[model samples]
Target: MSESKALCTDTELFAAALFQLQVSVWERTADDIPVRVEDGGTIERITPVSVKINGIYYVRSECEFRVDRSGIKS
Candidate 1:
């Protein structure tokens, strides 16, 4: 399945990243496209942007999820 998400504001950056990013099911693959989440870095900010995964794309909405701090260390 392919998905695409766009960020409306900086707050929705992670939501876009996380949206494109896959969790648990294929956590190991994240090592390749860690671009969304800075390596050894916490989600700082995000701007309205387009993301594509598995030939699919999605738009970030206002309901996107946000984090106060880095969800992961590595």
Candidate 2:
């Protein structure tokens, strides 16, 4: 059996929505490589609870972001 936990409370979700908050996601590679910005943008919507599927729990959220073409590798 998997332990269930709430991703976020309803109050927190309301506050985030009310403030129209933003979030930044970072990625780290090897030990020598520094962390880099992967994806970031405004928080459009979020699910307060985690959804279970195939014995796995997932928390989903939506955001508006722009892709940096320069960061793309050939």
Candidate 2 TM-score versus the reference: 0.29
- Span of 10 residues, lowest total lDDT, candidate 1: 21-30
lDDT, model 2, position 13? 40
Tell me how far the alpha carbon of residue 22 in candidate 1 is from the true structure, in angstroms, after superposition: 3.1
List candidate 2 segments past 4 Å from native: 1-8, 25-38, 50-74
Best by TM-score: 2
- Give the Å shift of residue 34 in candidate 1: 25
Model 1 clash tally?
Answer: 7
Candidate 1: tens digits of C-alpha lDDT, residues 40-74: 22233343543333433333331233232333323
lDDT of 2 by residue, 23-58 (tens): 333334566453424333444554544322223333
The CA lDDT at 59 in model 1 is 37
Q: In model 1, state the lDDT of residue 73.
A: 28
